[model samples]
Target: MRGIVLNATLAAVKFAGGVFGNTYALIADGAESLIDILSSLLVWAGFRVAARPPDANHPFGHGKAEPLAALAVAVFIFAIAGWIAWSAIREILTPHQGPHWATLPLLAGVVAVKLWFSRRMTRASEEAGSTGLQVEALHHYSDAITSAAAFVGIGIAVWGGPGYETADDWAALLACAVILFNGVLMFNRALADVMDTAVSPEFESEVRTVALGVPGVAALDKCRVRKSGLSHLVDIQVRVDGELSVRAGHDIAHAVKDALLASAPHAISDVSVHIEPIK
Candidate 1:
């Protein structure tokens, strides 16, 4: 919620500054920030749905909705980038007088705020295990860099003395490129999550170590893991001693689950263990 509010405020400021200053780069940057606001809102909405208890229709809970929201954000980013690029091309073809000199200070302020927001949100998202929030943080970080580029362009346009106004168009063009690149990156990441990619190797290794450590477990046969939003849904198969009783196998499985939960509290959402007698 805090993230959402911050993004919304930044978006409004950028939009207003961009329009009044008659700076294409600033306007593009502002548009990207607006996209961030939408992304943050989508993330918050997804989390809200995810928190709902499992019902008859969605036995697995609504966690997957978070990734879907991320996908939507990616699409929105792509559309915004496309629009910005089109406008930039038009401006370049029909050269225009530069933006207001005052926009430089405003852009600098925006850059600073974006940098701080990115760092803080990144840490918070990582700790909370919210991949969506992390992606949004990255977006803000990228915005800062692009906005800085715009600042340089604006500086050149106003003070370069001769033929520097061309720099303004170049800067807007560069900003458009950055926005497109970010949109592609976001799309790829969100698509991977929607496809249920395997969890990180570090996470898999931790799960294996815990499962193998369970008493009476002879060895690990298989471990399959998938992400559901910020959490992992693990399916593991372990080989236990053939002589072990049913109760012993159950206890061992429970131990493995508990150990995994303790080891990676933020990552492990649920664990399902299959016990097979050692051959």
Candidate 2:
């Protein structure tokens, strides 16, 4: 919420400054900030939906909404990158007067804010285990880089040699490439979550250790883990004595689940344990 508000305000400031100062780089940076606002909104909405409990229609809960929103953010970033690149090319072909001197200081301020925001967001994302926030933090880092480029663009336009009127355009073009690269990375990460990639090796090991500690009659067979937003669901198979009664096996399964939930580091949504006869 705070991020959305701050980015929106910055977007307005940069766009207005760009028009008055005749700086294409500032305009492009402002457009990126506008998209940043949109991305933050999508992330907030995704988390809200993800936190909802399981419903009759969706048994696994709405946790997938997080990755879906992350994908949306990546798309927005791609669109902005393409637009910036196209505009930069046009500015390069038809040279224009350098930016007004006032735009330089304004863009410098933007770069500073983005740098601070990037660090703050990175910490928050790590603590929350939020993929969307992680992507947004990287986006902010990219924004800081591009805003620095914008600052240089304005500086070149206002103070460079007579033939360097297009320096700002070159900077904008570089910013566009950075945005595109970051967008692709963020997209791949979000897509992996959507595809139900396996949990981290450490998390899996932790679960296995907890499962083994439970008082069971035999060996463990298989373990599978799937992520659903901030939480995960687990499925395991265990082998017990062939002569054990069904109720006894059922009780053992519940005990394994309890032990795992009590010891696992992450929030586990559910656990399914399958009992097999010890061969």
Candidate 3:
């Protein structure tokens, strides 16, 4: 919500500054900010859907929505990158006057604002362990990168005068490459999550250790952990004495599940335990 509002306001301010101040780089930055508003809206909707509980139609819940949203964001970034690149190239080829001196301060302020928002989103992403939020943070950082580039490019144009008018356009072109690179990274990450990639070795090890600590569990035969949005789903096989009664084995399985859930309430959303005979 905050992101949407901020992006919209910045987009308007940047567009106005770019048009009146005669900086194509500022215009490109504004276009990126406009895209950010759309991306934030998509992320917001995805999160809402992802938070929905499981239903008869969907047994695994709606967690996939989060990654789907991230994927959409990546697509938007690619489109915007292409648009900015085309615009920058056209501006570079055309002869134009240097940007107004006032636009330099505007670019500087934009860089500061984007950096602040990037930090805030980074903290939120870490705490929530959300792919969508992480993408949002990257968007802010990318915006800051573009804004900083524009600041320097405009400074060079205004300082050197006349022949340097194309410097800001070159900077905008560079920003497009950076945006496209980030888009690829975000797409790959989101696709991995959608494909149900295995959790990290260290995280799986932690889960295995917790399961082993439960009483009656002799050893673990297998432990598989996969991420679903902000949480993890675990499947594990634990070896037990063959002599133990069926009821005892069931109890042990339940105990293991309980311990894992208790250890990381926010992380582990569900667990399935398979009890195996030691023979």
Candidate 4:
């Protein structure tokens, strides 16, 4: 909720300031900020649904909804990028006169705001252990970079001699390119999450190490991992002593779960162990 509020407030300020200052680069940056606002709202909605306990309709709870929201955000970002690109292309073909000197201060102010917001949001995301928030923080960081580029371009247009009037247009074009690149990145991440791709190689190795450490476990046959918001859902098949009692097998599973949680608390949320008697 706090993330959503910050996103909304920053987006509104950037949009209004961008238009008033007549900085296309600034406007594009503002549009990117608006994307963050929309993405944050989508995440907030997903968290609401995901927080609910498992029900008959969803035996695994609604955790997957968060990834679905991420996918939606990716699609929206692509759409915004397309719009920005189209507008920028038009501007390049038929350039407009530069705005008043007042745009310089507005651009500087935006740069400062973006720097502060990105830093604060990144820390909050890490503390919350929210993948959604972390991804949004990355978006904010990108916005700050693009905003800086825009600020520089605005400065050049204001100070550079007569031939440099189109610097703002070129900057806007560059900003659009940055936005498109980010859109592609977000789309791929969303697709991978929805497809249940393997967790990072490091995370997979840690899971195997922990599972193999179980007392009676002879070997690990298979390990699968998926992320749910900030948590991980892990599934593993392990070979254990055939003579062990049911209770013993259960204890082994518990041990594996405990080890994983201790090593990477935010990485493993739920664990499922498949006990296979050693052959």
Which is better, 3 or 4, measured by lDDT? 3
Candidate models: Cα lDDT each: 0.79, 0.87, 0.91, 0.74
After superposing candidate 3, which stretches have Cα over 4 Å from the reference? Answer: none
Model 1 spans with C-alpha error above 4 angstroms:
none
- Residue-level lDDT of model 1, residues 1-279, one tens digit each, is 776677678778777877887777787777777777778789789878866767999876777887788778778767776776677778777767777789989888988988998898789777877767766776777788778888998898888845666576677677767767876777777777778887789878888988888777789989999887777889999998889899988999899888888888877778899999989
Better of 2 and 3 by lDDT: 3
Pick the lDDT winner. Answer: 3
lDDT, candidate 3, equals 0.91
Name the best candidate (by TM-score): 3
Q: Give RMSD (Å) of candidate 4 vs. truth.
A: 2.6
lDDT of 4: 0.74
**For every model shown, what is its TM-score relative to the native structure?**
0.91, 0.95, 0.98, 0.86
Clash count per candidate = 0, 0, 0, 0
lDDT of 3 by residue, 1-279 (tens): 999999999999999999999998998899899999999999999889988888999787788899999999999999988998999999998999899999988888888999999999989988988889889888888899989888888999999997999899988889888988888888888888899988889999999999999989999999999888888889999999999999999999999999999999988888999999986
CA shift at 229, candidate 4, in angstroms?
A: 2.2
For candidate 2, give the lDDT: 0.87
Error of model 3, residue 252, in angstroms: 0.9
RMSD in order of candidates: 2.0, 1.5, 1.0, 2.6
